[model samples]
Target: MTLNWDNCPAVSRSSDVMSGAVVFAGTRVPVSALFENIEGGATIDDFLSWFEGVTKEQVNEVLEFATSSLAPA
Candidate 1:
C-alpha cells in the first residue's frame, strides 16, 4: 500500500514554505529534523522544547504513521 503523506496533518510541504521542504504543519522545522535529532540522542521532550509550534500530539501521530507504513503488509 502506498502511504498517503497528504493525510498526515502533522506535515506539509509547498514551494511557498521553506522551498518545498517537508516540515511539520505550521512550523518551519523539517520532518527530517525530528529523525536527525532523535538519532543524535535527543528525546521527544527535548525536540518539542527546541521547536515551538509543533505539539506532542502531532509528533506522536507522525511517528505512528511512519511506524505503520513500515510494517509488513
Candidate 2:
C-alpha cells in the first residue's frame, strides 16, 4: 500500500495556515489535536462534537490512511 499524504484529502498543510501544520482541510484544527484528545481518553464522538467542520467521513479517511500506512508492506 502506498503511504502518501494524498490519500487523505481531508488533511492538508499550507505555509499560510497555522505555520504549515497538518490541519483539517478548510479549518485550522490541527490533526494532532485529534490524536491528543483521543490519547487522553476522548472518544471519536466526543471529538466530533467538540470540533465542528470535521466530518466523520474525514476522520474515517484519515484513520484508514493511517492504518494502511502502518500495515506491513
Candidate 3:
C-alpha cells in the first residue's frame, strides 16, 4: 500500500531537530532509525518493536514523504 504525508500523523517541525545526518522529529527518534533498521535486515515488526508509538503505516508514510522530497526534478 502506498502511503503519503497527508494520511500519516503530523510530525511537527517545531519538535524536530536536525543534527548532521540524523533527523529527529519529536518522538526523540531519528528518522533514519527506521531506515537503518530496515537496511539491517529488520522487518516492519522489528521497527515497530523499537518504536511503539509509530505504526507500520506511519513508517511507510514517512518513507514515502522523504522519497518524494528528495526526488530529483
TM-score of 2: 0.88
Please give, for residues 1-73, the per-residue lDDT of candidate 2 as tens digits. 3346765898998899999888888888888888899899999999999998998888887888788889878
Ranking by TM-score: 1, 2, 3
lDDT tens digits by residue: candidate 3, 1-73: 3223333353433323544333333454656688788899998888888876776666776777777766876
Better of 1 and 2 by TM-score: 1
Which residue runs of candidate 3 sit more than 4 Å off their true CA positions? 1-9, 13-26
- C-alpha TM-score for every candidate: 0.90, 0.88, 0.58
lDDT of each: 0.89, 0.84, 0.61
TM-score of 1: 0.90
Off by over 4 Å in 1: 1-4
| lDDT computed for candidate 2 | 0.84
Q: Choose the strongest candidate by lDDT.
A: 1
